[model samples]
Target: MNKLSRLLLTASSIAPVCLTLIFIGWMKDSRSLMIYSAITAFISWGLCWSLMQFAEYKLERSHKIIDSLSPANKEVTNYFLSYLFPLLGTDSIAEKKEYAIFFYLSLLFYICFSENYNFNPLLSLHGYKFYEAEDDTGVGFVLISKEVITDIRNKTFKVVKLTDYTYLHTTDRE
Candidate 1:
């Protein structure tokens, strides 16, 4: 994927935390913080949804032959939990707005620069399923598909490459 697209995926990855911050601000009666966080959360979610739709419709597809494929749904939680460390300090967020801002901005920079865009919750929430696939050479890849692939080992699939290590299945879309 391109840098900007990767950035969007990273932003969406933290959107759930932003939504949580919005709720916290609301419970604390911090209207300004609530509105601000709400705006950011919705924008991240909306843009992510748009980008996924664009990929499903406008991107070109090619076939990939894989020797093995299996469900990878559990991998999503590992990615999701990595963002919760700073949340420990968020209990006093109203008084620590600067710290919270710096914390999240730094998190965003780290994730983007690190290029960990494989397990986005937004992709799962948008009806995509994750799979671990390996080629005949034993090289591994992350594959995203809309359909539930119960048994498709040693099959060729129409897919679009999202990154050097990730692909999106192109068939069975509604």
Candidate 2:
């Protein structure tokens, strides 16, 4: 779906829950609770849009990289990208890529906004690592600092760092 559709979907999905929470707060006459709920809902909406933008940016960059590769490498990359998202079960490369982005963004939304908006840094790191590990084409690059990626890999994967920037190895490489 496009940006506007995604935004509308997210708002529709979140509206009921947000309304319920705010209603409960209103009934209890807890101004603080109602205010917090409204703020949280707004932040969640903004984050979803931001994540979609980031995904689009990454998709464009990956397309450029894929275009620059040799035909043989491009085929290999396309194959991996095509099968990255099992839940979607889609044969279309474009749909698979969109599913992967949605999956990561959903995970990020859960980690950042759910459960009273308590940000779990470790969960976020692990989620990114898991997403990266699943993509054989190395196209699912989660935008994070190099140092953060290095730390997460060292702590979770225990793999030797290959470089300062590009360290995570895809399964198809070895």
Candidate 3:
């Protein structure tokens, strides 16, 4: 993935938190914050759509047989909670807002530079599932799929490489 896509994916990984921040801004009657948060939410969604398009028309895809798989949805819980749970605490909006901006920017930079498997709930909401998977030769990567992989022993997936450590897995289920 490109730097822009990586940055967008990093932003989108916090999609739920963005929506909540918007609501909090409204609840707190801060018009400036509410408007800004709304804009951020909209842009985040646009980024997701663009990524989908890129994956469909741009990424080189191939079939791969995965021999070992384990669900990795729990990773999102930790990353998400770190961004969200703090909002529920006593910190003021200004403090959290600044911290979040700084944190997200830093995360975007890191993601753009590093090969990492990003577990995103927004992608989950879009019918994607995350898994820790390995091939017969023990090569490992995070698989993002649309189908619930029940049989973990061996499965052939249409894989789109998103990064060195990540793949977008597709299969006909319906």
**TM value for model 3:** 0.78
lDDT of each: 0.73, 0.34, 0.68
lDDT of 1 by residue, 65-170 (tens): 8888888766467655755554566567755566656766777788777756566676778788878888667888878888888767667788877666677788
Tens-digit lDDT string for candidate 3 (2-76): 556566666777656666666666676656656666777678878876786678566777877888888886666
Among these predictions, the greatest TM-score belongs to 1
Model 3 alpha-carbon miss at residue 168, Å: 0.8
TM-score, structure 1 vs. true:
0.81
**Candidate 2 residue-wise lDDT, 4-36, digit = tens:** 333432342343344444554565565655575
Candidate 2 has what TM-score?
0.29
Per-model TM values vs. the true structure: 0.81, 0.29, 0.78
Q: Model 1 residue 102 lDDT?
A: 74
Put the candidates in TM-score order, highest first: 1, 3, 2
- Residue 7's lDDT in candidate 2: 42
